[model samples]
Target: MTKLKVAVIGCGSIAKHRHIPEYAAQDNVELVAFCDIVAERAQSFANQYGAKAYTSYEQLLQEADIDAVSVCTPNALHAPISIAALEAGKHVLCEKPMATSSEEADAMIAAVEKSGKKLMIAHNQRFVASHVKARQIIASGELGRIYSFRSAFGHGGPEGWSADGANSWFFKKELAFIGAMGDLGVHKTDLLRYLLGEEFVEVAAFVEQAAKENSTVDDSAVCILKSASGIIGTLAASWAYNGSEDNSTVFYAEKGILRLEDDPDYSLIIDYKNGNSERHSLGAIQSNEEGKQTTSHVIEQFIGSIVEDTTPPICGQEGKKSLQVILAALASHDTKQIVRV
Candidate 1:
């Protein structure tokens, strides 16, 4: 089997912490190159992974043998980099919050179609053990028609993840767009969509700059979504939680209420209407030398898609659908009214 050659753009925390290590672990993929505007950071990644380093994405895209590129760059650069890579005849795996706007996402989809190359978005929540199990339960009709629910993803701030802290692109409205909504909300939004197996029809959102001494964008947001299936839910995301990472989801159906969380052994709890409760424990994805776990599942699936010529679970269009919900929530926040998703 011919191994897929991968060039990862951007050597930031997400790239270093997840993408690079994940791609490296796949047996059929080679970490061919790393790129970052900060030359030294890219050099460091190259040294650590035994790959070449390039200061420019264009230079990396020029590699004749490169089969795929991961867009681990900031929000603003997502579309441009992915489009360029796709046009250069390489498959693209872009990080979530697919792009800053719907238009950029549309352009990316067009480019992917024109290039006839695979495009997958890194929505790792779908691969998490608990979420995968939750999806299974819903699909099995055990939930008995998911009617309404609520989900949240929150953390103290980007201090631990963003090297530049308040000055990080996450704090800048230009680069990161709406702070918590894009950073954290996008994940929960995507997870919700995947679990419900429905399309969000419209959104009404309330976003605020609730934390961080001074910031142009919101630090927290709560959104209400109406799905095409008539399911309703509230999605909350925050960077000002001032607590440990809180990622949880609850589903209320005619049969029961199902819940899942990151903590407490990563299990899904179901309370059925007959006054019975069930708990399903999920096995965690084994970690690699770098401690990267199931988040690497996307990399593995992407490589499989390359080899098998099949669409990965989270394809480019599926990614954009989730992004559209986040973008609509932002628009709703600005206009103070429900916006069509």
Candidate 2:
């Protein structure tokens, strides 16, 4: 088995904690290069992973032997960097929300088409055990006609998570574009669609900066979604939650209700009208500092798809759908109307 040569474009926390480590863990994936505008950061990441460092992405992309690259940069640079990698004939796995807007995502899709390389978006939530079970239950008809859902992702703020804090790119509208909606909301949007196997056709959202001072983007958002199947739901993503970490989803169906979350325990609880209740714990509680699942599974899946010439479970095209929901929520927030997804 020829190992895939991989390069990481951003030496940020996500790339450090997730992408690079995940790729390094894979036996058939080699970390060939690391790139970041901050030279020391890139150098440190490269040294940690035993890879070469480059200050510019162009330098990394020029490596002829690199087979794939992970674009872990800010939301603004995802499209351009991923498109460039795809055009350079390397498979790309970009972090979500795929880009700031749908047009940017569309251009990435175009580049992937032209380059004839696999492109995947890293929506790690879909790979979590609880989420996968939800999909299986819904797909197996155990949920019995899914009608509605509630999903949320919330935390304190970016300042606590990153050394940059409020000054971090997450707080900047130009870098992150949107706040919690993009950082947290996009995960649930994609997960709900994946679990229910439906598309979010419209969204009515309320986004605000409730707690964060001097924040240009939203700190919290409550969104209502109408899926293509006419199933309606509410989603909340916030950076103002004064709790530990909150990532949860509830599904309502004609037969029963399903709960999926990881805080208290990795459990799926179900309730039926017959006064019967069932609680399930899918014990894969390996969460990162940000409470993200061990995303190494997702990275491996993407690499496998490229190796096998098969579509990834969450390919770039499918990844765009999740971002579409979040972006629509932003539009709905701005207009105070239902925005089409």
Candidate 3:
């Protein structure tokens, strides 16, 4: 079997914990190179993996004989770097908040079309077992009409999880584009879209920099979103969620209430209108403090798409749509009015 030769761009904590580790575990893949603006960082990962390192991503793309690359760079770089890799005849699996804006995402999609290579956004929440099962239940019409929902993704912030720690790009407005909204909000919004099987059409929001005093980005945001099918909901993202993470969503439907990632013991819980209840302990999600690698099958799915010659589950178009929800919410915050997606 000819294993897929892969290179990782941006040897950050995300690469250290998720992308590189996952790629190394895959039987059909071999990590071939590592790249970072900081030569020492890239060289460290390369030495550990027994592959070459490059201080510049352009050099890696031009010289490495790799089949694909994982764009684990900052929010602003996702588009340009992924497009460069795609244009260089390499498949790309980019991190979330696919781009800072919809226009950049469109450019990425255009590049994908021109290159005829796969481009997948790493929205791993879709692959969580509980989320997968919840989608199945919702698709089965068991929950009936989803009237309202609350989706949240929050944590203490990226300080501990980022390679740069306190000075991580996640806290910078120029590099991150948006703070908590870009880091945590995109995940829930993307997951909500997948679970409900619909697009959000409008949003109203309040975004603020309430947590980190020195950062140039907002640390908290709350948005009210309405879906195409008339499902209204609240989406919250924050870096102020001290103590423990809250990555959960609850849906209120005609027949029942479905909650996911709410309870530590049960990942999913359904309470029927008939007074019956069901619970599922589908294992815990990947955690930073606990050092859990993943319940996130993002890498597996990305690799599978390349090997099988299938469209990525979270393609650029899908990622763009999810991103538009966040973009609309940002506009809503600035204008103090409902923005249409």
Candidate 4:
């Protein structure tokens, strides 16, 4: 069996904790290169993996012989780096939010089309066991028309999760684009879209920098969304949950209520209107802490897609749709009115 050569761009916390280790564990993958603007960071990862290191991503793309590259840079660089990697004839697994804006997302899709290579967004929430099961149950019509939902993703802040700590680029609007909405909220946005199997058609939002000091971007956000089929929901993203992380979602359907990631033991709990309940102990959701490494099915699915010559579960277009909701939310905040997604 031939091994797929993989390189990681931006040796940051996410790449170190998730991408590199996950790729290393894959029997069919050979970790080939590591790239970062900081030479020592890239060199450190390369030394650990016995791969080449480059301080310049352009040089790495030009020199490395790899089948795929994971773009784990700042949110602003996702589109440019992924597009370049795609044009260089390598498949790309870019971390979300896929781009800072929809126009950039479109450009990324164009590059994927031109290259004829796979482009998967690292929307890891979609691969969560509980979320996957919810999607399956919903698709089976067991939920009986999800009418509304309330989803949230919050933690102390990115300062604890970013490799640079308090000095992380995540607080800079130029790099992160939107603060909580881009960092944590987008995860919920993507997850809800995946779970509901519906696209949001309208959004109204209130975004603010309510918690983090010295931050130019929003630290908290609340968005009201309406799907095309008349499903309504609320999405809240925040960096002010100092007590504990709250990554939970409650789906209200005609028959019952479905709760995800809300319990300590069961990841999913379904309470039916018929006075019955179901509990599932599918594994816990991954934490946003810096050094914690958790099992993720993202790499396996990405590699499988390449090997089987199929589109990835979260392709560029699918990522774009999820991103559209976030972008629309931001627009709504800016204009103080509802925005069509």
Candidate 5:
């Protein structure tokens, strides 16, 4: 088997913790190059992983004999970098919130079409055991028509997760584009879409910089989303949770309520309308919290898609659909009206 040579752009927290390590663990992947604006960071990862380092992504793409690349940069760079990688005949595993705008996301999809290479968005939440199980159960019609749902992803802030604490690019509007909604909300948007197998057609949201000092983008947001099938729900993304991370979701169905990641003991819980309850012990959801190094199946799936010459589970088109909701939410917040996605 010829190993797929992979390069990583942006040696930031996501690259260091998830992309690099995960790629290295794949037997069919060769970590061929690392790129970062900070040469030292790139060089350090290169030394650790036995790959060359480049300060310029252009140079890395030009020089490395790579089959794939992971764009783990800030939200603003996701589209441009992913497009460039695709044009260079490299498969792309771009971190989520695909791009800053729908146009940018479209451009990425167009690039994939032109390049004939795979482009997978790293929406790792969909790979969570509980989320996958929920999707399976929903598809099985065991939930009996989900009427509504509430999904949330909240933490103290990105300061604790980014490479630069308190002064991270995540706090800057220019670099991050949007804050909590882009950072956390987008994950739920993708997850909800995947879980219900439905699209969010409308959104009304209140996005505010409620907490986190020295931030130009939103620190808290609550969005009301209506799916195409008329299922309505709330999606909240916050950097103001202040306590242990609250990444959980609950679906109110005709049969019962399905709670995901709400309880530490059990990852999924289902309460039937007929007075019966079931608890599932799926593994923990991935977190940025210290000492919680849960595995994300994103890299494995991306590599598998490329090796098998098949479309990724979360392809460019799927990513664009999920991003539409976030873009609509932002517009809804700004206009103070319901926005069609």
Candidate 6:
């Protein structure tokens, strides 16, 4: 078997903790190159992994002997880098909030279409054990129609996780575009779409900057979404939850309520309308917190899709649909009125 040579862009926290290590662990994948704006950071990883390093992704794409690349840079760089890799005839596994704007996301889709290469968005929440089980239960109609849901993903700001602490690009509006809304909010948006398997039509939200000092981007947002199926709910994403991370979602339905990641002992809990309850002990969700290092299976799926010549589970098109909702939420927040997706 010819191993797929893989390269990782950005030597930051995400690349350091997830992309690089995951790619190395794959039997059919070889770590060929590493790129980072900072020469030292890139060289450090390349030396550790016995791969070549480049400061510019353009140079890396042209010089490296690789079959695919992972765009683990800041939120703003996702689209451009993915498009570049696709055009260069290499597959891409891009980190989420896939792009800053719908226009950029569309261009990325166009690049994939033209290049005939695969592009998968790293929305790992969908691959979580409990999240996958929740989707199955909802699809089985076991929930008896999801009337509403509230999903929230919150944590202390990225200062503790990024390569540059408080001075991280996450707090800057130019590189991040939107703060919590882009970081944690987009994950819930994608997960909601995955669980409900429906598109949202309208949104109204309050995007605010409240917690971190000297931060230009919003630290929190509360959005009410109305789906095409007439289901409505609130989605909250925040950096203000400075205590401990909260990655939980609750679904209110005719049959009962399904609580996901709400309990440490039981990851999924179902409360039946007949005054009965069931609890499930599915595995944990990946977290940025120290020692929270469970495999999300995103890299495995991406590699499998390529090796098998199958469409990626979360393809560029699917990612675009989720990004559209986040764009709508931003409009609703700015106009102080409901916006259509």
lDDT of 5 by residue, 142-203 (tens): 97998999999999998888998899999999989999999999999999999998898999
- Measured on C-alpha atoms, candidate 5 has an lDDT of 0.93
| Candidate 3 lDDT over residue span 111-213, tens digit each | 9999999999999889999999999999999888889999888889999789899989988888999999989998899999999999999999999998897
lDDT of each: 0.84, 0.84, 0.93, 0.92, 0.93, 0.93
List model 2 lDDT by residue over 63-96, tens digit each.
6469999998888899999999999999999988
Can you give the lDDT of residue 216 in candidate 3? Answer: 95
Residue-level lDDT for 175 in candidate 1: 80
lDDT (C-alpha) at residue 45 in model 2: 77
Prediction-by-prediction clash tally = 0, 1, 0, 0, 0, 0
lDDT of 6: 0.93
User: In candidate 6, which residue ranges exceed 4 Å CA deviation?
Assistant: none
Lowest-lDDT window of 10 residues in candidate 1?
A: 285-294
Estimate the overall C-alpha local distance difference test score of candidate 4. 0.92
Q: lDDT score, residue 278, model 2? A: 78
Question: Which segments of model 5 are wrong by more than 4 Å?
Answer: none
- CA deviation > 4 Å runs, candidate 4: 290-293
lDDT of 3 at 293: 62
Q: What is the lDDT, from 0 to 100, of the residue 141 in candidate 3?
A: 96
Error of 3 at 243 (Å): 1.2
Off by over 4 Å in 1: 284-294
lDDT of 1 by residue, 254-283 (tens): 899998873467468898999998887776
lDDT of 6 by residue, 122-142 (tens): 999999999999999999999
